[model samples]
Target: MGGTNCPTCGTQLMDGGKIAGRRDPGAQDVSICRGCAEILVLTRSAQGLTLRPTSATEYLELPEDAQSLLRVAHLLVRRQQRLVRAPRQLH
Candidate 1:
């Protein structure tokens, strides 16, 4: 399940990546890598779900519907603006 790579550190995600804690599970959907703290968005297709890197600029580029979701997410939880350093792999 951990096949996706972190855009920031290139660390492979585990368990299809960890869910970014959200108050509104319906609107606030996000995935993150524990190794690099990189945020991502899942794009679903006929094949399956694919995770894409998410940045502040990218968020602005999102469609209005997506923007609305983010807005709702903001009211629910204050997202971290700073980059979280990648933790060392135990291996």
Candidate 2:
């Protein structure tokens, strides 16, 4: 997986970079496209996963209201990571 390339940007993930909307941790990951700087979703089925640029392109054009939800989710996740890094001191 370390040598895997981003489905969206086609950039090689040197150190096993994880992508958003990914169900699995690293074994099966979705990555943000460096070329477009947007999250890339892969089509999964019996054939296996494949990048559908049309879908990703459409998602990027979603209305602000729909896109805002993603922003908040990312913000919350970031906040959680920060909290995990900094332990609260008990008085």
Measured by lDDT, the strongest candidate is: 1
Query: Candidate 2 — which residues are off by over 4 angstroms?
Result: 1-4, 12-21, 25-31, 34-36, 54-57, 60-66, 69-91
How well does candidate 1 match the true structure in TM-score terms? Answer: 0.40
Give TM per candidate.
0.40, 0.35
Model 1, C-alpha of 84: deviation from truth (Å) = 9.7
Q: Kindly give the stretch of ten consecutive residues in candidate 2 with the minimal lDDT sum.
A: 82-91
lDDT by residue for model 1 (1-91), tens: 4425555566655443443432223333465544445456655555544566676776667677866665654433323534444432311
The alpha-carbon deviation from the true structure for residue 85 of candidate 1, after best TM-score superposition, in angstroms, is 6.5
**What TM-score does structure 2 among the candidates reach?**
0.35
For TM-score, the strongest prediction is 1
Clashing pairs in 1: none
